[model samples]
Target: SGKVRAIVDDKGQQLKEAGPSMPVEVLGLGGVPSAGDNLTVVENEQRAREVAKYRQELATEKRTALAPTNFDTMFNTLSSNVIEFPVVVKADVQGSVEAIVNALHNLSNDDIKVRVLNGGVGAITESDVLLAGGSKAPIIGFNVRPNAKARELLKRDNVRMMYYDVIYHLTDAIAKEMIGELGPERIEHVVGRAQVKEVFKSGKRDKAAGLLVEEGVIRKGLFARLTRADVIVSATKIASLRRFKDDVDEVRAGLECGVVLEDTNDIKPGDQLEVFSVEERERTL
Candidate 1:
């Protein structure tokens, strides 16, 4: 709807009704909209644009959130099937050592032992290399420059030296080492084995006996000897054993356990008992 108005002169005479002697002004007849009245529509359009933009941003964020983490790729690159020795990380700086230690501490498996052979703030010297050489561990230099001599030594020893400005890469390398493929056990041997020293009975009748774990770990389901000066008294399956009040399936050297021999009562003190386990292996010939 539009409103109409007549044009008026300065003396208040309408243009249509003014005589020829009086001047008149002509004016257009519609009501024009104010800026304030149009602002609402503009605001609504702006809000719609903002909402669309926010939705697009949300979608982008969702895609990023669903993406796989770097750690997953690192695990895939590093994980191994066979058991491996712990990776020894030798760093030139204390901060690098701490970073490696923290990374190792956060890992899932407790089998990997990350030891810092040389952790100090300074240039990599021959001494540091020698220290790493002692352990035959890998060296990681962080922010510290490695001299030519150290590099030559590392090359000569075939030692792996990794340099990193970021801690995450160092951590990733360690993770990769942890996850790298491992070969099947090629050699096996009893590293250390010993015979039992003495067996003492608690009661006069000798129902249970205190046996010293003198050999390699006395596993629960392994063969054990009960000897009395070259005489075989009894062969027992470790029925129930406790190490320092905690029940364990095996006891290592310098440990003691109470054992119940099977089908034998001839155990005597000073009898040298031997505990051994048969190691089964498959040779890849």
Candidate 2:
């Protein structure tokens, strides 16, 4: 709650009161008002305090409702494959905070996700530093500086601090960080395709398939998938390749060879085997 000390016209003349659409300056605000906030004159100071307390309670309830509380839910996050990068954000204005938070959220993908613990306008405070310290999350400030108490706590707790004035730089840096955490990307390339002509018993408990190389080339010890009616049955590797009881390393297109797949026994004639290899490449955002 704040008291109106004086209302002055644009020419520095004191005014008894001001009306809508009048050019005047209002003095004695308790806090810096955010853009689009309503300036309403309440009945009394006590009523203003009551409204402020109620709004504070509502904000607290919203925060508590968004937080994870159950043990199962907490443990699930710890055991998940997706990596989470938590951060606290502070900006010079509310609009800047919203833009930064939205940009960070948009960078999330299947491999990694960004979690903003808290976002607020104005300078970073001690409470924000404490929250970041508790969560082990870094603090990102956009066109805003931390207070002396917050700086002291950040140094004492060894928290990471990032300051940026440009929005794109902040987003690009975060994307690169996520890519680094996820490591390289794997790409699969199909090397060969072969159709099974016959299935016969190779040993007492093992079965082998006679494959006719339909395209490319099939090599022994390469990864392959067994497909029936265009549906994948199992993924197996070529254990052995033979032609007329003679061991062969590979068979080119338009050739017939017997192949024993490792750890797979569901072999059938007229099935298809797709041979492929994997390559690792640097990941990008």
Candidate 3:
């Protein structure tokens, strides 16, 4: 019988069946195979080459399809002003990892967002550290931590590692960090406007300007902007607001008022005054 230890063609081979010598032509896969195991019964050398070629083609196509294109994503990200905290997640349990990732992905907005770079179940390893470093992302591991080698690399690369024993703490810390990164958006609102009717000197060089409230009411302690022909000449606060020598809370339009800018008396007749204040809005990711 021909040796079957190595891959061999069944055609033109000798076999002993029922103690009778015969030339084997029929092929049979003699052993059971599992799902991923290949059972190749080639009839000749040419057939083996054809099978090898087909597998190579499949591998090449798969590689081409899976390769990533990140240039455009990166360019747009760099140009825009969005707070994106790129993060890599690891956990000890599959369920924990899935739950944490789901919770994180739900937090989103146009100005701020969390970009998960990679995620998996397992203790944090050296490969995880390397991937985080390459992506400029921090590693967040839940109920897990880095190995000795991974810790060394993390220190050398100056990568931030945040590990938490409790799942709530992990999510909370990340949320806080995202909020901090989001910061606050500033909205400038113009409250009122006035024109300096006359400049009157009061204390030493300090002068209180007689004003006519042109648009909105100018209130006491409101921020004041002294402008000449749309150019900001001075920015100050309303130190004193009065009418007819009596301190008043506010003066309405078409009313003559006395307005004193805090710590400044640089008032000139015909200068436009814009009363405005900047308000902050808390943003989220």
Candidate 4:
């Protein structure tokens, strides 16, 4: 006779027969079998239950061993408002790191200030956390994450790690910690727009652009964005914004002016310029 399996119900009564070649649809009955029904092939269902119960008990005991131990709790003696906030900053890109570092540094004051222990561009690594641990600084990341080992170390050491997707939010949160009150939300408001009408060559090394202010007022020393068609070409600071042959502070909408972009001279006609400024309230958290 070929091998076969007897299907049993919760009452331990045979319901049907199944082929042994396919194995039983279920193994080791647990608790009370119900109407949905399960077919088990084990000859000793009681023994399987014993093993599962032992594993569950072991797991519970292990969990009980891992008690609370975070960095915040370990460093309860650290004083507040008496020292500068030492921070280690990391981001996905160099420009982002620079921007975030600058924003954080701008939040320092007489009462409490920001002191960046270190700054870098990359996924936060184990070494970074170790560095921060030595310096007793909190690690702040922008558009990045801690590596596997770093995460483990942070949990084990109770190191503070804060991550954010937006630079504005990241800066605001850190600012509030230093200022002791939640300040205003930072906003980027557009100031002016200009269309490049022509490119001018001044010297072998110097170059400038002739622009027509299309909207708002284009001011000197403001940040600018150069766009071609509908795509962004560059985002840089205005080295010099001039009108006529002399340097002027600003030009109103619909006026023609000259612009010198820092570190770039590939200005061309049909390029659009956008100027914006960062505005915010005066509070902190």
TM-score of each: 0.32, 0.68, 0.53, 0.39
Q: Roughly what TM-score does model 1 have, to 2 decimal places?
A: 0.32
Which candidate should be chosen as best, given lDDT against the real structure? Answer: 2
Task: Give the candidates in order of TM-score, highest first.
Answer: 2, 3, 4, 1
Q: Model 3: residues >4 Å from true position, as ranges?
A: 1-79, 93-99, 130-137, 155-158, 164-169, 184-191, 196-210, 224-236, 239-253, 258-272, 277-285
For model 3, the local distance difference test gives 0.76
**Residues 131-222 of candidate 3: C-alpha lDDT, one tens digit per residue:** 78977888998888888999899999988999887777877888888888877878878888999989988888789999999988898887
What is each predicted model's overall lDDT from 0 to 1? Answer: 0.56, 0.87, 0.76, 0.74
Model 1 lDDT tens row, 1-285: 122247698887666554555655445422222223221112354565565456545643562242446987667547633333333344555556667667655753534434444344556666556656766667677776667898788777777677877878877766666555332334434322335445555456545566676656666655666666688777665555666667777777777776655556666667665665556443221
As a TM-score, model 3 comes out at: 0.53
lDDT of 4 by residue, 36-153 (tens): 4343334465665665556545643453232337777446425344346778888887778778888887877655667776676778878678767876778998878998999999
Measure candidate 1: CA RMSD: 25.5
Better of 1 and 2 by TM-score: 2
Q: Where's the lowest-lDDT run of ten residues in candidate 4? A: 25-34
Candidate number with greatest TM-score = 2
List residue ranges in candidate 2 displaced over 4 A.
1-9, 12-24, 27-31, 40-87, 93-118, 126-137, 147-160, 181-183, 200-206
Candidate 2 is scored at a TM of 0.68
- Per-residue lDDT, model 1, residue 219, is 66
Ranking by lDDT: 2, 3, 4, 1
Model 2, range 1-285, lDDT digits (tens) per residue? 577889999999999899989988789766556676667789887888788668645654574353457988888767778887888899988889889999999999877889888777878888788888887888999999999999999899998899999999999998888888888998989999999999999899889999999999999988999999999999999999998889999999999999999999998888999999888998876
C-alpha lDDT of residue 25 in model 3: 38
